[model samples]
Target: MRCETIREALSARIDGEPEPVAAGSADRHLDACADCRSWYRRAESLQRTLTARPGPPVPDLTADILRRLPPDWPLSSVP
Candidate 1:
Protein backbone atom coordinates (compact mmCIF):
# COMPACT_ATOMS: atom_id res chain seq x y z
CA MET A 1 0.00 0.00 0.00
CA ARG A 2 1.12 3.57 -0.64
CA CYS A 3 2.05 5.82 2.29
CA GLU A 4 -0.97 8.05 1.73
CA THR A 5 -3.33 5.07 1.66
CA ILE A 6 -1.85 3.66 4.85
CA ARG A 7 -1.94 7.07 6.57
CA GLU A 8 -5.63 7.41 5.72
CA ALA A 9 -6.34 3.98 7.16
CA LEU A 10 -4.25 4.57 10.32
CA SER A 11 -6.98 6.47 12.14
CA ALA A 12 -9.57 3.83 11.32
CA ARG A 13 -7.19 1.15 12.58
CA ILE A 14 -6.63 3.06 15.82
CA ASP A 15 -10.39 3.43 16.24
CA GLY A 16 -10.98 -0.23 15.43
CA GLU A 17 -13.36 0.76 12.64
CA PRO A 18 -11.38 -0.50 9.62
CA GLU A 19 -12.15 -3.82 7.99
CA PRO A 20 -9.60 -6.58 8.64
CA VAL A 21 -8.11 -6.34 5.15
CA ALA A 22 -7.58 -2.59 5.38
CA ALA A 23 -6.22 -2.85 8.89
CA GLY A 24 -3.80 -5.54 7.85
CA SER A 25 -2.64 -3.46 4.91
CA ALA A 26 -2.06 -0.49 7.17
CA ASP A 27 -0.16 -2.63 9.65
CA ARG A 28 2.04 -3.96 6.89
CA HIS A 29 2.75 -0.48 5.61
CA LEU A 30 3.46 0.80 9.11
CA ASP A 31 5.97 -2.00 9.60
CA ALA A 32 7.87 -0.90 6.50
CA CYS A 33 7.52 2.88 6.92
CA ALA A 34 9.23 4.58 9.85
CA ASP A 35 7.39 7.88 9.38
CA CYS A 36 3.99 6.16 9.36
CA ARG A 37 4.93 4.16 12.42
CA SER A 38 5.79 7.38 14.27
CA TRP A 39 2.50 8.88 13.18
CA TYR A 40 0.61 5.85 14.39
CA ARG A 41 2.33 6.02 17.77
CA ARG A 42 1.47 9.71 18.04
CA ALA A 43 -2.14 9.06 17.12
CA GLU A 44 -2.37 6.32 19.74
CA SER A 45 -0.81 8.58 22.37
CA LEU A 46 -3.25 11.42 21.61
CA GLN A 47 -6.22 9.06 21.75
CA ARG A 48 -5.10 7.75 25.12
CA THR A 49 -4.55 11.25 26.54
CA LEU A 50 -7.92 12.56 25.33
CA THR A 51 -9.78 9.48 26.58
CA ALA A 52 -8.17 9.77 30.01
CA ARG A 53 -9.06 13.42 30.53
CA PRO A 54 -12.39 14.34 32.15
CA GLY A 55 -14.99 16.02 29.99
CA PRO A 56 -15.54 19.74 30.36
CA PRO A 57 -18.02 20.82 33.07
CA VAL A 58 -21.32 22.33 32.04
CA PRO A 59 -21.57 26.12 32.43
CA ASP A 60 -24.00 27.64 34.93
CA LEU A 61 -25.96 30.54 33.43
CA THR A 62 -28.19 32.55 35.70
CA ALA A 63 -31.75 33.60 34.84
CA ASP A 64 -30.72 37.26 35.19
CA ILE A 65 -28.38 36.98 32.21
CA LEU A 66 -31.04 35.25 30.17
CA ARG A 67 -33.55 37.97 30.98
CA ARG A 68 -31.08 40.74 29.98
CA LEU A 69 -30.64 39.40 26.46
CA PRO A 70 -32.77 40.84 23.63
CA PRO A 71 -35.61 38.58 22.58
CA ASP A 72 -34.33 38.46 19.02
CA TRP A 73 -30.69 37.89 19.96
CA PRO A 74 -29.40 34.72 18.34
CA LEU A 75 -27.29 32.22 20.28
CA SER A 76 -24.83 32.16 17.36
CA SER A 77 -24.04 35.84 18.14
CA VAL A 78 -22.51 34.80 21.50
CA PRO A 79 -18.91 33.65 21.88
Candidate 2:
Protein backbone atom coordinates (compact mmCIF):
# COMPACT_ATOMS: atom_id res chain seq x y z
CA MET A 1 0.00 0.00 0.00
CA ARG A 2 1.01 3.58 -0.59
CA CYS A 3 2.47 5.58 2.27
CA GLU A 4 -0.39 8.05 2.05
CA THR A 5 -2.99 5.31 2.43
CA ILE A 6 -1.13 3.74 5.34
CA ARG A 7 -0.82 7.11 7.06
CA GLU A 8 -4.53 7.70 6.74
CA ALA A 9 -5.18 4.35 8.32
CA LEU A 10 -2.69 5.11 11.07
CA SER A 11 -4.46 8.39 11.80
CA ALA A 12 -7.81 6.67 12.02
CA ARG A 13 -6.36 4.00 14.26
CA ILE A 14 -4.83 6.60 16.54
CA ASP A 15 -8.16 8.42 16.80
CA GLY A 16 -9.86 5.17 17.85
CA GLU A 17 -11.90 5.23 14.67
CA PRO A 18 -12.23 2.39 12.18
CA GLU A 19 -9.20 2.09 9.94
CA PRO A 20 -9.75 2.18 6.18
CA VAL A 21 -7.26 -0.64 5.80
CA ALA A 22 -7.11 -3.83 7.78
CA ALA A 23 -5.03 -3.65 10.96
CA GLY A 24 -2.78 -6.58 10.04
CA SER A 25 -2.05 -5.12 6.63
CA ALA A 26 -1.17 -1.74 8.12
CA ASP A 27 1.04 -3.40 10.70
CA ARG A 28 2.84 -5.40 8.05
CA HIS A 29 3.47 -2.21 6.11
CA LEU A 30 4.71 -0.48 9.24
CA ASP A 31 7.13 -3.35 9.89
CA ALA A 32 8.81 -2.76 6.51
CA CYS A 33 8.50 1.03 6.14
CA ALA A 34 10.96 3.02 8.23
CA ASP A 35 9.48 6.39 7.20
CA CYS A 36 5.99 5.33 8.17
CA ARG A 37 7.20 3.98 11.50
CA SER A 38 8.80 7.33 12.21
CA TRP A 39 5.65 9.13 11.13
CA TYR A 40 3.52 6.97 13.40
CA ARG A 41 5.77 7.57 16.38
CA ARG A 42 5.63 11.32 15.82
CA ALA A 43 1.91 11.24 15.34
CA GLU A 44 1.41 9.28 18.55
CA SER A 45 3.67 11.62 20.47
CA LEU A 46 1.78 14.63 19.15
CA GLN A 47 -1.53 13.13 20.07
CA ARG A 48 -0.38 12.43 23.60
CA THR A 49 1.00 15.93 24.05
CA LEU A 50 -2.18 17.54 22.76
CA THR A 51 -4.45 15.54 25.01
CA ALA A 52 -2.25 15.70 28.10
CA ARG A 53 -2.60 19.41 28.73
CA PRO A 54 -5.77 21.09 29.93
CA GLY A 55 -6.81 24.32 28.22
CA PRO A 56 -8.19 27.41 29.95
CA PRO A 57 -11.53 26.94 31.59
CA VAL A 58 -14.53 27.58 29.37
CA PRO A 59 -17.02 30.24 30.44
CA ASP A 60 -20.75 29.57 30.31
CA LEU A 61 -22.42 31.85 27.77
CA THR A 62 -25.78 30.15 27.48
CA ALA A 63 -27.75 32.79 29.32
CA ASP A 64 -25.98 35.67 27.60
CA ILE A 65 -26.58 34.12 24.22
CA LEU A 66 -30.27 33.43 24.90
CA ARG A 67 -30.83 36.99 26.18
CA ARG A 68 -29.52 38.46 22.93
CA LEU A 69 -31.89 36.43 20.75
CA PRO A 70 -35.51 37.39 19.98
CA PRO A 71 -38.21 35.21 21.57
CA ASP A 72 -39.19 33.98 18.13
CA TRP A 73 -35.82 34.37 16.47
CA PRO A 74 -35.71 30.81 15.26
CA LEU A 75 -39.42 30.54 14.39
CA SER A 76 -40.88 31.76 11.10
CA SER A 77 -44.21 33.64 11.01
CA VAL A 78 -47.17 31.35 10.32
CA PRO A 79 -49.18 32.00 7.18
Candidate 3:
Protein backbone atom coordinates (compact mmCIF):
# COMPACT_ATOMS: atom_id res chain seq x y z
CA MET A 1 0.00 0.00 0.00
CA ARG A 2 1.06 3.60 -0.54
CA CYS A 3 2.61 5.49 2.36
CA GLU A 4 -0.29 7.94 2.72
CA THR A 5 -2.91 5.21 2.77
CA ILE A 6 -0.88 3.13 5.20
CA ARG A 7 -0.11 6.11 7.40
CA GLU A 8 -3.82 6.84 7.83
CA ALA A 9 -4.49 3.19 8.66
CA LEU A 10 -1.54 3.06 11.09
CA SER A 11 -3.57 4.59 13.91
CA ALA A 12 -6.51 2.25 13.40
CA ARG A 13 -4.14 -0.73 13.28
CA ILE A 14 -2.43 0.30 16.49
CA ASP A 15 -5.73 0.94 18.26
CA GLY A 16 -7.06 -2.39 16.97
CA GLU A 17 -9.89 -0.62 15.14
CA PRO A 18 -11.04 -1.47 11.62
CA GLU A 19 -8.51 -0.44 8.94
CA PRO A 20 -8.31 -0.43 5.18
CA VAL A 21 -5.31 -2.73 4.84
CA ALA A 22 -5.39 -6.46 5.54
CA ALA A 23 -3.44 -8.12 8.36
CA GLY A 24 0.36 -8.03 7.89
CA SER A 25 0.02 -5.39 5.15
CA ALA A 26 0.95 -2.55 7.47
CA ASP A 27 3.93 -4.47 8.78
CA ARG A 28 5.08 -5.10 5.23
CA HIS A 29 4.73 -1.43 4.34
CA LEU A 30 6.69 -0.39 7.41
CA ASP A 31 9.52 -2.75 6.55
CA ALA A 32 9.85 -1.35 3.03
CA CYS A 33 9.13 2.36 3.76
CA ALA A 34 11.45 4.19 6.11
CA ASP A 35 9.27 7.32 6.11
CA CYS A 36 6.13 5.39 7.05
CA ARG A 37 8.05 3.48 9.70
CA SER A 38 9.29 6.73 11.21
CA TRP A 39 5.78 8.16 11.13
CA TYR A 40 4.40 5.05 12.81
CA ARG A 41 7.07 5.19 15.51
CA ARG A 42 6.31 8.83 16.21
CA ALA A 43 2.58 8.11 16.34
CA GLU A 44 3.14 5.25 18.75
CA SER A 45 5.26 7.45 21.02
CA LEU A 46 2.60 10.17 21.00
CA GLN A 47 -0.15 7.68 21.92
CA ARG A 48 1.99 6.36 24.76
CA THR A 49 2.56 9.86 26.09
CA LEU A 50 -1.10 10.78 25.82
CA THR A 51 -2.25 7.61 27.58
CA ALA A 52 0.35 8.05 30.33
CA ARG A 53 -0.63 11.63 31.22
CA PRO A 54 -2.66 12.23 34.40
CA GLY A 55 -6.28 13.09 33.86
CA PRO A 56 -7.57 16.54 34.75
CA PRO A 57 -8.35 17.14 38.42
CA VAL A 58 -11.95 16.95 39.61
CA PRO A 59 -13.55 20.38 39.35
CA ASP A 60 -13.71 22.38 42.62
CA LEU A 61 -13.04 19.29 44.74
CA THR A 62 -11.33 21.21 47.53
CA ALA A 63 -14.11 23.78 47.69
CA ASP A 64 -16.78 21.08 47.72
CA ILE A 65 -15.03 19.15 50.50
CA LEU A 66 -14.44 22.26 52.55
CA ARG A 67 -18.11 23.25 52.22
CA ARG A 68 -19.17 19.83 53.55
CA LEU A 69 -16.86 20.08 56.58
CA PRO A 70 -16.93 22.52 59.49
CA PRO A 71 -14.90 25.72 59.24
CA ASP A 72 -13.03 24.80 62.46
CA TRP A 73 -11.89 21.58 60.80
CA PRO A 74 -9.39 23.57 58.74
CA LEU A 75 -5.82 23.41 60.09
CA SER A 76 -4.77 26.80 58.74
CA SER A 77 -7.22 29.16 57.02
CA VAL A 78 -4.74 32.05 56.81
CA PRO A 79 -3.70 30.92 53.37
Best by TM-score: 2
Give the TM-score (vs. native) of candidate 2.
0.72
Q: Looking at model 2, how many pairs of residues clash?
A: 0
- Candidate 1 lDDT for residue 4: 71
Cα miss at 8, model 1 (Å)? 1.4
Taken over the whole model, the C-alpha lDDT of each candidate is 0.80, 0.94, 0.84
Model 3 TM-score, all chains together: 0.68
lDDT of 3 by residue, 16-35 (tens): 78988875898888899999
Model 1 agreement with the true structure over 12-69: per-residue lDDT tens digits: 7778785445566777788889999998899999999998999899777777787889
- Please report, as a residue range, the 10-residue window in candidate 2 with the lowest summed lDDT: 70-79
Off by over 4 Å in 2: 57-79
RMSD of 1: 5.3
Alpha-carbon lDDT of model 2: 0.94
Pick the lDDT winner. 2
TM-scores, in order shown? 0.62, 0.72, 0.68
What's the ranking of the predictions by TM-score, best on top? 2, 3, 1
